[model samples]
Target: MNHQTTTIDLIRHGEPEGGPKFRGSQDDPLSVLGWQQMRSAIQDEDQWDVIVTSPLLRCIEFATEVAKQRNVPLHVEDRLREVNFGAWEGKTTAEVIAAEGNKLSRFWEDPVANTPPGGETIIDFNQRVVEGWQHWRDQLAGQRALVVCHGGVIRMILADVMGIPLQKSFGAVSVPFACRSRIRVDQSDFGTLTSLHSHG
Candidate 1:
């Protein structure tokens, strides 16, 4: 039996205009440095056959540029957007800590259990991301693809692909700005994390 393989590279958007904060669903554009960081991350790599990105401006803007430069197909996937933080949207860590006390820490410890008030639950977020990932994986099978998305989105997909417990995903994976992770899936739908890179 011949086994088909699919390659995917997941890249998190860099710093946004508001700097570091709970940027979920905020739709902020990338900062100047964010653009530089993203460019630097992919400067040496342009082997993708297609580029998929979140609907958010931060991911789409850069994805668009790269797709055009590489002359590849570009897709904007809504499910690839970051988790919605609801009441915590657009707030800094210090602000959230001051307002909600240890809730932030607890949420970090186990996002599946301690959801931010009014935020999207980890279960729901994971489901959507997995669905989106499956769609892309199947749609672009046997091709190398790049997914430009948010940190939370990448973490959830990575957890699903690698069998990392959803509760432990936050602590197990660290997806900083412009970080890139590669996944290769075989004909049996088994995925392996091939490599992970963090760009400065």
Candidate 2:
């Protein structure tokens, strides 16, 4: 898994003050334990070729620390940003449920077709994320890279690559804040296992 062609360690930034609650885009900095989580996630591993981040402040702060600790350049990719929660940006899940009632319950089933009040659709998210991956694939051919992104993006990547039904995306693993997901993609040979290969 170390020949080259990148073993992208996609990491979701730590939880900010309004995390696991509202706070979707816009701007929100990491909390105290969030910073600790970021430090712990990459402290033991310092061999990444490059550190890329989402434009969000939460991700940027953590990515900056990792870049400094590992002595690598920090690059920002807007497409790596989280799904815009729109009207729900600052509301709790329960609030959404109470507001939309039964309709809200179906969000997980057809988010691609449904719009979240004033937020981006699932289809839009998929498009942008894939675009981001392609951009990096071109630049990081035969190299290693580290990508900092959001929990939803990571879950989408896992769901799309693993062939999970789009409706079941919410069933993806519990992504701990600032944790690492090391995926090694091989261009020379294409296979599902190629994405699972990891060295660090």
The C-alpha stretches of model 1 lying farther than 4 A from their native spots are 188-200
**Tens-digit lDDT track of model 2 for 1-200:** 33445577888888787656656686888888788777778747458778888999889988887788778888999888888888878778788888877655566666665667888888778778878866885687666788888887877777656676666665445676776777776654343244654422
Clashing pairs in 1: none
**On a 0 to 100 scale, what is the lDDT of residue 109 in model 1?**
90
**Sequence-dependent TM-score of model 2:** 0.86
Residue 152 local lDDT, model 1: 92
| After superposition, candidate 2 runs with Cα above 4 Å error | 1-3, 189-193, 198-200
TM-score for every candidate vs. truth? 0.92, 0.86
Reference-based lDDT, each prediction:
0.88, 0.75
RMSD (CA, Å), candidate 1 to true, equals: 2.6
> Backbone collision count in every prediction?
0, 3
lDDT of 1 by residue, 18-98 (tens): 899998999899999999999989855569999999999999999999999889999999999899998999999999999
